[model samples]
Target chain A: MNEIPVGSSATIVGYTIHNAFTERLREFGLIEGTIIKLLRKAPWNGPIEVQYGHSQIVLRPDELTNIQVKRMM
Target chain B: MSDELPQNPSLIALVGSPNCGKSTIFNALTGLRQKIANFPGVTVEPKTGTVKLSGETSVTLIDLPGIYSATPKTPDEELTISVLKGTHANITQPNAAIFVVEGTNIEKSLFLYAQYAKLAVPTIVVVTMIDAIKGSGGVLDDIELERQLGVPVIGVVGHRGIGLDEIREYLECGDFQPPLLADNQVFTGKSTIEDQHLWAREVAREVARLPEMDSFTRRFDAVLLHPVVGPLVFLLVMLIFFQSIFTWATPLMDGIEAGFTGLRGYVEGIVPAGIVQSFLSKGMIAGVGAVVVFLPQIIILTLFISLLEDFGYLSRAAFLVDRIMGVFGLQGRSFVPLLGSFACAIPGIMSARIIPSEKDRLTTILIAPLMTCSARLPVYILLITAFVPNSLVWGFLSLQGFVLMGLYIIAALSGLVIGKIFKSTLFKGSKLPFLMELPPYRFPAAQNVFLTAFNRTKAFLTSAGTTILFLSIILWAMAEFPRFEAPQNASTADIERLQLEHSALGMIGTTIQPVFAPLGFDWKVTIGVLSSFAARETFVSVMGQMYSVDVSENNESLRVVLQRSITLPAALSIIAFYVYALQCMSTIAIIKRETGSWKYPAFAFAYTLLLAYGAALATYHVGLLLTS
Candidate 1:
């Protein structure tokens, strides 16, 4: 998806993680089936907070676009 | 042997996903005695604090930036990995790790915990936010998660200061008694542990519970987060913030002026009418006074900011702006470091720890000085008030305030554009993926608010005492050295200006004058710009010293000086110069410290200087053309 609406829930699909995002995701177990909730967005909606399982994590939007997500209930 | 505790406090490195209340738990465990340093090789920040466990065992708590892996994405992310592996250049490996996890999202929080479990350090998991999900009828089987994950798990409400002592006791003993992996079997191999993924699933299914979304939160989100209205609300809130900085700070600013005047008068009277008085009143008092007058701006700015963060609106604010930032190739997580840059760029660079991508965080740090800090407010006020007329556009809005706000806006836009260009040219990388946790909005604690305000104000004053003090003395020497013996008041303005042309500073300024003349600047303004390399706000004090004028009167004090030879447009040029300038040497130093390498900071300094010179030159010569 070119644009993910703020607060819209989506399933983790695939991602193009930079070395930093990839390394952090590896530690957090952000691999297959990691359900993400698009939490709060800002004025321009560039950086976002996501709900990965019970714990929520913050990431730049660059990391999100790569991880393909399927819109979920 | 049973009661043995190490002579030194056990060091526990707290690592987890961001916003898992790891900071809250760190504060609860260590309170205010925390030492913060920018991480080596990157602007990422790590905080070190200590908590006493038992008589013999206290914990040296290092709150690492939230990272998901032992392997890092950006230089910022590598801080935890290298340090944890005992392979970092500056630090030994941490003795243990306190892996923080969000209770509501235990399965995900445990993902990182599982990674840490294999690290071979003594690891303990503190399940935070238990109270946040308490009313949801959701409770964690902490013991079970601990069993399944092969780490000791302690559930606590860190925000409320609950479960702190049990945490201490757990840290006192570094042994892990994990849950039975298939009937009390001792774990033998990596394959066996990976095979137990199903075991973790079964435990989560049995013990963890979550409730439906709370109505108040949902309703609040409906309006605050409404796509149509969200951006508008965000703009208005920012407007109120910028306005309060000028309007609300007036009384406090006036009080500061009065205090400085009183101190100058007292020091002048007591020190007698010799070099000491001149030194105290002119050099020290004047220099420090110029810095402290901006205290009102610092206090008001940080007060509103702390409240915004406490209310949990800062993240939401970031969320709203993420889409537009993407167009510039700037990541969404840049908001924190850029926001922090308003106080000082060092901390701004350091706060980049929160950004998961090294490229984005370094990019943010590189452009941070473009943010208009309170330190630069004095120079802006000095320029705008001295030249821009005091008039109202409509019935109410003061023209001066409008110009001030415009200057801030210009600085912010410059940072973003420069960030985009920097990424494309020097730091070539695709924008890294980014995400953040949105905590349920809560009324910020009064203590947190007060502390934040206190810290900001205190730092501003210290900046005056340290870097400002040193720069002021040098500027004073430049102005007063090779003293001019004058006959009368009618000795001519041209002579004084010429006499300044001979002084150490003026000579230096004149040499640089030709270089800046195309930009419409004379030698004096050039000197002010050079002196300000130490501290941006020192531009005003340097001008005051150079002109030998009273600066305590604010607008009236500088107007007569500027009105003498400088044009309305020339003064505007200086303002433009200050707007784009990366004059703070300390900011550069901070960049060096945060990046841990000369390469990124050098790149940051070079590009920013280029942008400043180009923009300033454009504003200067173009304005001269229009006015001519």
Candidate 2:
């Protein structure tokens, strides 16, 4: 997930750990099989901005590491 | 249970995700009839307002904290869920819930709505930002949404009052029924997040066409969120924010000060020139004026905050600063409150409520006062101008200006360090994963912005104002009593000085003088420090009174008198002390209210006092060594 290029689309596969944070992400429409686009990453390994289901969310790098995703062409 | 219910005014809860225009709808619906109430044992204060449903029928509208889910993750979310479940002791279960959703992003909204539906409260779907949907070339069939979701759905541009009449009609008619869930659609309070997301997506796809990414937002984000340019833009924006507060609010503050001075003069002229005149002009008027003088700064700070928030830039700014603030164990959201502390810590501390995490919020509140508020500027200026030379330091930088800038830098550095220390010691916990919504940019609604500023300023006045006024009167009495009889030939200034020397505050200052003697502060300086607790700027006035500096004369006379009485080491020590001390009564009062306990504010006061004393002691000794 960290290596995903900006503007690339991906499908959420599953979470590495289930917790309140991931649960919140899911509630914000980051469920499995959901298509998400990597909008941009903040400078200095800061939070990554992602677009999923017409909503843009900023998630820290550690949080993004928990979610496994498959890149789409 | 039935008997416990209120006899009238059914409670309606407005629930939605953060930045979903929930507050805008709330402000529009309630207008100016709202009051914020703290729930028992929680820091979250839900705002409730009386909304007229009909000619005589009125309902209480409670605006719940925005939550991403019914399952509580933060204190705010916990409060929302507890209130909705009727588990909160102070608030009864709302009779109905108006689940506000953004029309442009209904899919994300439905996920929370699906979980909310299981609570079985009669619910209405309010799709706000409907105009944004149309502008983005998408369609929302609210009627179809209503049919699909089994609840009354109303689409409205809340800021503009469009479609508000339909919403009022629904509330007035009292026709809200519990949502009728289909067998497969029943959430059952046990649905997984995945299942809920899928269900919400299906429903949203069925009823509304999802809008494309807003072009304007995307274009703006490209520059504003750029790695280099984003932070630069953020810095520029913050510069403008602080500059406006100082530049714009100064005239209004000066006007308020002048008005109060005129009023005091008028009262003095009418009242008999004795304790009565003193009480009326000094105790009451001066006390009230001190609190009222902060109104312009509070209004401006809150107005800027509301504008940034409403325009959807605050969160983006938070994102830009998250990494840097993370190093200090503070989140990006803490930036705004800390920035606001420069204007006044009262508004800054109050604004700390925006940080969702309890520990983060508390840390921000605790460190806000360390940011060197405007109240500390007079003390800093007096000391620097008197002691520091006006000669240029680095070819162009005036030594006086450089010293002032250095004091500000020191205060900022100490704040970051103390914030980190507190986070590690007292507030240590697992860091909450930083998750924020970069809400789409939109034109800020003028009504909402002004109302927010007005309400916040009003809250400050009502809650903190009374404490400040009361303390001001008490301090005034302390300084005014124990009148001394001077010789018949003594001048008015000499008599005034003698009176202050013999007063209770003077005696206490003399008693505390030995304690601060190591820091090079004399009894007069001690008295100035003690009196400044009412408000930091009072130090200058107190010193003026102690030195008998004529009010008609400029600060030059006062500065000369101060320079003659106080040594260079003492001046440096005083500057060091003022840089760190939590001297404002209003800040302490607001902290007590915001933290919902005296414990945190008490702790804050103690730690800052110690820091101030130690810093002053160190600075005084260093100055002595350099002079020798």
Window of ten residues with lowest summed lDDT in model 1 chain B? B190-199
| Strongest candidate by DockQ | 2
lDDT of 1 by residue, B4-90 (tens): 753233677888866667877887787766666544443455777779666755668888877644445555457788878788887
User: Alpha carbon lDDT of residue B344, candidate 2?
Assistant: 82
Overlapping backbone residue pairs in candidate 2 total 0
Per-residue error (Å), model 2, residue B399: 1.1
Question: For model 2, how does the per-residue alpha-carbon lDDT over B416-505 read when each residue is reduced to its tens digit?
Answer: 989999989998874356778888898999989998888888788888899889888998999888876788998878877888889998
lDDT by residue (A1-73, candidate 1, tens digit) is: 2366766877656555545455445445455555667765444534555655544455665455556778886
lDDT of each: 0.67, 0.86
* Top-lDDT candidate index: 2
Model 1 segments more than 4 A misplaced? A1-73, B1-9, B37-42, B53-57, B173-200, B212-217, B244-246, B286-307, B335-356, B371-412, B440-465, B482-502, B528-564, B567-572, B583-612, B623-628
* Interface RMSD for all numbered candidates: 4.5, 1.6
Clashing residue pairs, backbone N/CA/C < 3 A, model 2: none
How many clashes in each candidate?
Answer: 54, 0
Local lDDT at A4 for model 1 = 66
Name the 10 consecutive residues with the lowest summed lDDT in model 2 chain B.
B181-190
